[model samples]
Target: MAKKTNKYIKPFKNIFVFILLMFVVWMLFFDANSWLIHHELNSDIEDLEAEKEFYKNEIIKDKKAIKELSTEEGVEKLAREKYYMKQENEEIFIIEYQDSLPKNKEK
Candidate 1:
């Protein structure tokens, strides 16, 4: 009958719509280059930008330190601390007591 055929057509149309909707959802979320992937890439870019800012600040600090090292006292201090350089006939005595100190217990 015509009524029976019309009922079948309606269900088929609904199924087609559902399939199209699912396909769109799959493409938006499950595809290789999807919206979620773009969001992750944006987050990665933000993190890299933050790291770039941190490195820029560090570079500024290093330039300041290099400028200071150009002076005589700063160079001598750096040599004594890092390379353990001593003046002629002067002895260097390093006293390490931090390891011997008692550590505080956490409550």
Candidate 2:
């Protein structure tokens, strides 16, 4: 009687199972739309979504400010503070914070 030997083949799992595992592994790492690619694309999508939300909030704030600026009082307030506009012959005195003042040099 001759003894048969299966050196490389595993008897526990079928060939089909081994091939299926290999295919899955290849797709996960080496394929074009792999797991790593999917993860990076999802991260990009989340960042873009966050940026979109930020810009949407900024747009809403800008629209509200524009509506406020449509009024005379809003324009006067903005001009007075932002541009430091004053009436003719009006003297404006600016008070600076203590921290903002120049430090004294030791003699």
Best candidate (score: TM-score): 2
Tell me the number of clashing residue pairs for each predicted model: 0, 0
> What is each predicted model's overall lDDT from 0 to 1?
0.91, 0.91
lDDT of model 2 at position 64:
98
lDDT of 2 by residue, 1-107 (tens): 89766765564258787889889999999999999999999999999999999999999999999998999999999988989998898987888999999999977
TM-score per candidate, chains pooled? 0.61, 0.77
List clashing residue pairs in candidate 1: none
lDDT by residue for model 1 (1-107), tens: 54555764675478788798788899899999889999999999999999999999999999999998999999999999999999999999987798887898977
Off by over 4 Å in 1: 1-27, 30-33, 98-107
Clashes (candidate 1): 0
